[model samples]
Target: MTESRGQAPRSGLSYLPGEAATDPDGTLTAIGRSWTWILGSAIATLVPGVLVLVWPDETLHVLAVLIGLYLLLTGAFRFVTAFGREHGERVPGLLVAVLFVLAGVLCLRHPMQTVAALSLIVGLTWLVSGILTLYAALAAPDLPHRGVVVGVALLGIVAGIVVLAMPTASARALTRLLGLWLVLLGIGELVFAFAWRAALRRGDALPGAAGPMD
Candidate 1:
């Protein structure tokens, strides 16, 4: 089935079975493209979570600042990554990046906001990002390792729901819960980064695949 012409189209990095082999230099170009930005995004998320957990005594102000930094850094990484994706598949990644930046700005602007406000900001961001990612994966018929992508998206959705549903009366509680979820989400994204890299390599190894671009 063909995509409707009227629709603007959904986008993200994806490749189909044997697609790399058939496209001249496309597979090589993709393989040569560093997937490290995803790794960096994972690290950006992991560091803030680790710090929040380790510094449990830190005030709400400190926590907000940390989260804001994390979001901003992640957004930057994702923005770079979005550009690397095939033209038709860049929207989801770009949107996610923008969302992170917006949320980061909010966190940084009001670092002194109460626990509920902070949670709401983070929760809604995650939930919306997750939905976007999941939709893209499902909509992309040729996406490789579809399961892994779906799994990562599901993880984020679960984290968002948990954070939103659980009532946190104090900074410490939010710290613990949000910190744990961040770690989990980071790990999930980390795994996804590696998985996608492996898939790209496999695509390049197929018969008739082009050599890596200079």
Candidate 2:
């Protein structure tokens, strides 16, 4: 039987006037196109994270400098990716990027003080990064493997809270935790990058759209 005019489709796919249409395929294609940037960002994060973990015996000053550089580079990469050809929304990425940069600068300018307040600084950074990542994962319906992204973000938030709750923790412990978190985050991104590549090769359509519910 023919449906009546002005009625919603039986499939339940409905869109309001002036709303942007869902483009699952386009979204996937965009991600595939930006694989290089994504992979680079992941590598950039992973390398320093590994260095930090392997050289745990380093002095507090060295630790501070390394962490600061890591944060700074990570932030810069994120900022670039947000404005790059592949990213969806710019705001969330921008906010995360700024927080990372600030945290890095703070560490560098006052290395001694940073070591003294390592827990607070690292905790705040993780919390902020996690929140932003969670926001992006949920908001960007076009993002592939969103479940994994959410998982990673939650890990970051939980780790941050744990560190903050124990402000008196030793510098060595905090450094280790931070390194582990960065490594995990990097791995997550790498997974996402490869997944996107695979999907693109298979010509898979990512579910959801940049528009309102349909």
Candidate 3:
């Protein structure tokens, strides 16, 4: 989500597609209110991260498979979320989805990949997604809860950097680090979702906010 509900910042949303914010004229637009998919994306990430954390003893192969599944699911979530954006804004979401899917594929197909290889794939995806998300947040100052959006983007950027910089010696070590970041990312997205929901509610209660949804 370059702007809300969708990116690698992708599943929990390294980007939202606007990270679907991009609401012009200071009102909550349809896309701005799309918190459901955001929640779905968060769940996709949180579950996998939690699973990895709980099962750190799992082999590298198992870790790869789990990560692969998370990426694929995130890709799917991002893909659907892309449509919530303006046509011109769809490209970023679609791009993130592709990146996630490709990474997932690589992970699943080659579970025996070295720790560095796996880290490289995931880190790159997150880095790119975070950059896109930051771009969207900067470009759209009017985006609702812009501060939260920026915060999430920064978290993603940091997560990417840390993972790339600290390729752990073993699968267990990597598992702990990745799980922590994923959980943090998921929490960020979860907050964004509820924030959007609250904003939508407030907007609906406004004097003339019902026109778009109808």
- Order candidates by lDDT, high to low: 1, 3, 2
Instruction: List candidate 1 stretches off by more than 4 Å.
Output: 1-33, 204-214
C-alpha local distance difference test of each model? 0.67, 0.62, 0.67
Tens-digit lDDT string for candidate 1 (75-156): 7776666544455566777788899899999999999998778888888878888887887677665565667778878888
Q: Write the per-residue lDDT of candidate 2 for residues 40-120, one digit (tens) a residue.
A: 667867787798899977888888887788778877766655542223455676777788899889988888774448668
Model 3, 1-214: lDDT tens digits are 2322322121111222242344443223333235666777888888888988888788889889988998898887776665555555556667777888999999999999876777788888888877777765665545667677778888888889998988855666767888888888888888877775665554421111111101
* TM-score, every prediction: 0.78, 0.73, 0.78
RMSD of each: 8.5, 9.1, 8.7
1 against 2, candidate with superior TM-score: 1
Q: In model 3, which range of ten residues has the least summed lDDT?
A: 205-214
Error of 3 at 89 (Å): 1.9
